[model samples]
Target: MQKSFLIVVIVAIVGGLAIHQFVPALSASIAFFAGAIIAALLFKLLPSALSQGDGEYSGPMMTLYVGNLPYRVHEGEVKELFSQYGEVCSVRLVRDRKTGRRKGFGFVEMPEASAQQAMAQLNDFVFQERTIKVREAKTQDSDSTEKNPV
Candidate 1:
């Protein structure tokens, strides 16, 4: 049993070295496959492992609130401006329900990773002659009016 184990280890080492030296692409392919398998395993196992503690934790997609927009700046303009940073999912410019006029504020939705970068770069950015305020959007429940009663 001991001899067989030793022989197997020696054969694996020699075969790995041979593959690395003679067929470098094959070694890279093996590494890619191994990495993919590990990633798949982690994806399958990590959420359940993490949820055992308190509650299931999931990261929220990034949504940015953009304020002080020039009234002329529409959804297309906002989308165009943000697309420079990343893939913009949607742009919603707030409008008055009665008058159908822009309210100078809007929300922009993007993937989490790109949204962070965009927020950092675009906050207080001068667009259409106005310094726009860009930051993570607050949900309705978190709005100050709910906490402070008049």
Candidate 2:
């Protein structure tokens, strides 16, 4: 897919150059607009469009600590619940590494305003027979790299 898009972009650029040889003024304007569009896509659109992995997100966002989640509740369900308030950037349910069991808590990432709203509404809200808690995630002083420090 990317290869195809690249091919199209190259073709457009080549065609624009050919047009420039025939009509310099018209093609200069066209080239200017085309460059702007390409620059916008590359600098603005591309990063956000492709930032779907792990903890990647664009714009101002907040991470909420969602506690007391039902062990059986799916990530999609949590995402749906938060999406009602605002766009959910990501939902990550913490799990035990050894047994792969959900730890009954998770982190939800969303826009700052949306997170505040969700924290207001969802905290202490009952879902799946559990009263959950939602609040701004406390930033830890330690990072993963030091987990197995010798």
Candidate 3:
């Protein structure tokens, strides 16, 4: 499939040059070939943007909402729960900073592929007698709405 696309691109460029007998038509043909080459490259590579980039998303982080955790669930337990899917880089239970108690939610970080796998497999799996809600962690910037102070 990719080879076919490459061949088509080369043909377009060659055809453009062959038809370059008239100056105006030649320029348009050259421009069209250039556009086709770029478009083909982008089509072949667009899917990789979701998984590969300039370290923009190294590991996929997940935010989980846990319920009925026996009021004794700690970071360790969260790590243990998610460890079944992949290496747990970090587990942070949301807590009242002053009170230092779990707020029924937490975040876990793992490799991007592993995180995605975990989410698909564990989104509603039961744990510690309660169903959990697991998904990609949304950054603070993403959650906040821009307010235009008029």
Q: Top TM-score: which candidate number?
A: 2
| lDDT against true structure, model 1 | 0.77
Clashes of each: 0, 0, 0
lDDT of 3 by residue, 58-118 (tens): 4545554444444567788878877788777777777878998877777787777767778
Each prediction's RMSD over C-alphas, in Å, is 14.5, 8.4, 12.7
TM-score of 3: 0.51
Off by over 4 Å in 3: 1-70, 146-150
Per-residue error for 13 in candidate 3, Å, reads: 65
lDDT of 1 at 74: 76
- Please give, for residues 12-121, the per-residue lDDT of candidate 2 as tens digits: 57655666777787857696556556644664556544343434445799999999999998899999999999889899999999999999999999999999999999
TM-score of 1: 0.57
Candidate 1 clash pair list: none
**Candidate 2 collision pairs:** none
Candidates 2 and 3, the one with greater lDDT: 2
Error of 2 at 123 (Å): 0.5
User: Per-residue lDDT for 79 in model 3?
Assistant: 81
What lDDT does the true structure give each of the candidates? Answer: 0.77, 0.81, 0.66
User: What alpha-carbon RMSD in Å does predicted model 2 have with respect to the real structure?
Assistant: 8.4
Where does candidate 1 have its weakest 10-residue lDDT segment?
A: 49-58
